[model samples]
Target: MTLPAIIDALQCGTFDREVLKMLRDGGYRCVTPTLGFWEGTLESLDSLARWRDMERENAELIRIVRRADDIRACIADGKLGILLGYQNTNLLEDRIRYVELFADLGVRVLQLTYNNQNELGGSCYEKEDSGLTRFGREVVEEMARCGILADCSHTGDRTALDTIEHSPGPIAITHANPASIFPHARNRSDRVIKALAERGGVIGCAAYRNITPDWACATARGFADLIARTVDIAGVDHVGVGTDFSYKGDDAFRAWMRMGRWSRQLNYGAGSASAPGAVSKPDWLPSADRLSDLVPALGEVGFSEPEIAKIMGGNWLRLYEEVFG
Candidate 1:
């Protein structure tokens, strides 16, 4: 018998009917789409509304997933469940109450910062990492109270650690890799990984090329090897996949992601200055359709069938139930 549908814990891309179809064809039952990459209240509201409209428009093929049980039901019924998420807390606009507001809006995951300093905390790319501020602590508390999962993907090291320590519940580094594997600024250290696992949190190993050694060698098997190593370090129960896949490869999409509305000049944050607008995806796992390749790759790397199942989706499912429910 086939395994249950997989859940991609973190995905940063445009969500539409085509994307849903691709996920369905790829055997995904649930995906948490990050519609609020750098969006504030109005922008996040608009994006969330658009997705809600899409859910309504394609009710037969997809539905909004608010609870953990919805995931298995969607898979059993042959539909894709969209779990709304935000990559930054810009939508809160400094008010702690907005955490509950956005939580009610179907945002299950909320990243504290996105590549730069925000009102709440510092980012990994900053010249001096300032860590989480007083307000940031309040936001974490409110998120726990409101049943929203705290994420620290692009947050500064100090801030990420602060959030993990300050949070009343487990927090996630939703889309980052181990810095030990490939020393990128965006990757987390073993210290952080251990702290996260100790707190009952999960880390989703990212598939972005910049986080790895080189795009040419970052094939599906190579990525799976990285995951295997991560599992060895963080334990299989504390690791999952967060592909960070972007459907749009155009310069416009690149500009929006890199610069957002923060600057007019190109900011080569993750990508290179020479190819600032180009998205370098591995051929072996180019899109959501190729995610299934990880199963066999994980097996080849010595992950048992049960372990592979947990790494693929079961781990994330448990995290969602604990945090979102």
Candidate 2:
């Protein structure tokens, strides 16, 4: 089997009305944001300067989805629902107040830290991780109050644990894998992985091609293997697909990824051979992309039909409903 059309959900950049139409035309019901955002994007929402020019260039196809029911409804009606999220909190600045503001604007999930240390907490890319500070606690509290999911995918070890322990609402990790199987700072440990599952959260294991040791299970198969292993450790109900798809202009994207808040600052962001690099271009859309290949990949790993549904999008939908409905 090739794959299904329902996927090709969200991309890192370049969503326009024409893009949305093509996605809808392809029979896509919903498009999940494996990684919901970039720093320039959130800042651009308020200012039209650089982002404005970009938006105008890609006009008509961009949307920010913030609710689970919205996605279900859109998928049912043959439209695409964009799940609003972010890869880092640098866009939030220091004011935790922005969490609710973004929530009001339809941003549902937020990663505590991005590539480097922000005011809230230390990032995986940072040389030292001191965990969540008082300010970071306030940040998590605000996230709970606003009903936005607290994400730990890019957070440091201690910070992630602290957030998990303190978050009032169920937490969400958009993308990760087992560091034991493949050593990577972006990956999680068994203890933390199980903790997330026990805490009623979902861990989205990505394609992470760079992190995989086995060449045979590279694409969807590799993605599924990590998800399956995570499910085995955390249970089926705690897994989902967080592709970490960073689709955009290659040179520009790499520049952004390698830089800190300012340009020309090279940072060692987290990852290993098991993980995939960022997305490729601004014009790409995952909705029209073939994503269902993971279903068979799941089958190869002995995942039953029901488990497949959960890993694909069921668990994410359930959690999304719990917090964002």
Candidate 3:
């Protein structure tokens, strides 16, 4: 079967030369590599510089995408287009003007919060969801004006809903699952999903273990079923895949993701002390190169050719066009 331009809406990995080759060889046209989780402005800026250096060093394999056309250009030129995204808005601090500054620097997407509440709003794990703060509303507006896509994947339900209502254009839940299916704090509830769809946003179904409906049986079929269920809730056009694949990270990285220097005590999110690291990736779709395996699995689960194409990358392309253009 002919494939569409495959875009991994969110991938957590070290975009090394090897990973870039894997993604290119795996038939990924464009990928959004998440950056700035628990990072301050200086650190995030350094990360962006590192990505730029990587793009230069591996010019044949990948290029940084700054506009909607860059994605198509990379596809035609046979190079992976990398869209740098911030997993949290902590980098912005109190300076709302930084939105346009980073946008100018090719930061196309930014999530309002990670696992903890920030100046913008509350996180999913927060005991009290502060919802969208007044500053958060301004941030959303500035993001819309700057053509930066606002993501609510790790945001509180109330904050997510408030964001959907406040944003001038469609936003994204870049990497998450439906709470109805997985019952995890990282997953979105039905109400949030419906509101996101109503506002023309897309939810990229995540393939991480803890959020999967059946983690022990994390097969391609199960992943496809997750996508199908999301389609039922948000329609096929608003459903896509965000693998959340972490190609290279140690236990330190995992701990940092959960704890993030905010606490001295370890915080095992989605895992306990016994399993104090990232949940295992699905056995079938485990890495960047193995993403194509989902095509057949999606077909097996009753997705039409066009629907599968949409879920694979077409939906993300449409969203990028609308938001990044």
Candidate 4:
């Protein structure tokens, strides 16, 4: 989850607040990512300055997770652990060596591209992805050397496949959907999804705008349902939770996303689901224990508890161990 979601839950929504309480109450720990905003040579802050400030300024149910043991300890002690991450390579800018710097900063994962093309490679929203660029190839190599998992969530199809096929270590699609179900440049094709699983990689199914079965997803159950569908396609052990929740941005931000602020027309001005069952809002940020509710949803589809566990967070844990340990 992103810092915006955390801050919102802690301050705005009672239900969200209770959701966190329920997770801890149920003995399941919530682990968050440190947030890869305001990164780069300290100049790129102009792009994500406000959001980064929210993460740094706001206090909430967050614990900075910088080590492998930190994750283990979070689960053991019943606290939500955070894994810092970057959604785009903008922060890295021209510094490919910065991949190692981020790794040292405890950035466990990185999405190569965001909504548009960048120095690394084309995004899923790009017009065409002709595999890895020279710089992209180097970035891939650097990430692997640094032992930080590469995320192709927003990468173009060709680039995504090229990186996965050539990666020296396991790579992941941190958050995405099946293009077969929902045709989208941002979604993964079945072939790509299967290839990722074949290499001990996990696909983090996203529950956001156009990523869902219908127009908008308003409930965590709906997101879990999508996850269950992905498990059916890729198997339970090959998929996990990577809800790409960024709820703090307003309508202007939405227009910027759709109008191609990063790339051209990347976001499409879609709103997220703030509450369950909302028609326009996509409930991207669900309660922390929202993962647990996936149990019954999957059960309705005939998935066992153990399988559900893998989809929830077990598989993610395994990948972290394999890559980081």
lDDT per residue for candidate 2 within 94-208, as digits (tens), equals 7777777777766667788776777888887678998998989998989888878888988888888888898787787777777887787777788777888778998876554
Clashing pairs in 3: none
Please give, for residues 234-297, the per-residue lDDT of candidate 3 as tens digits: 9988999887778788888887787888899879876767877767667887676777888888
lDDT of each: 0.84, 0.65, 0.88, 0.63
The list of candidate 1 runs beyond 4 A from truth reads 215-218
lDDT, residue 134, model 4: 90
Name the candidate that leads on TM-score: 3
Worst ten in a row by lDDT for model 2: 279-288
Candidate closer to the true structure by lDDT (higher is better), 2 or 4: 2
Sum up the clashes in candidate 2.
28
lDDT score for residue 267 of model 3? 91
For candidate 2, report its TM-score.
0.81
Poorly placed runs, candidate 4 (over 4 Å): 1-40, 43-61, 215-225, 255-289
Question: Which candidate model has the greater TM-score, 3 or 4?
Answer: 3
Candidate 2 wrongly placed segments (more than 4 Å): 1-11, 16-28, 32-44, 47-64, 214-219, 263-265, 268-288
Q: Pick the candidate with the highest lDDT.
A: 3
List model 1 lDDT by residue over 1-325, tens digit each: 2564677878866667788898977878888888876777898899988998998898888988988899878868988888888888889888888889888888888899987899989998998888889999999999998889999989888898999999999999888898988887899999889889999899998877777656423677888888878987899899998888777557777677778998978698777766555656877876778889878878888888888888888888888888877
**Number of the candidate with higher TM-score, 2 or 4:** 2
Give lDDT: candidate 3, residue 153: 95
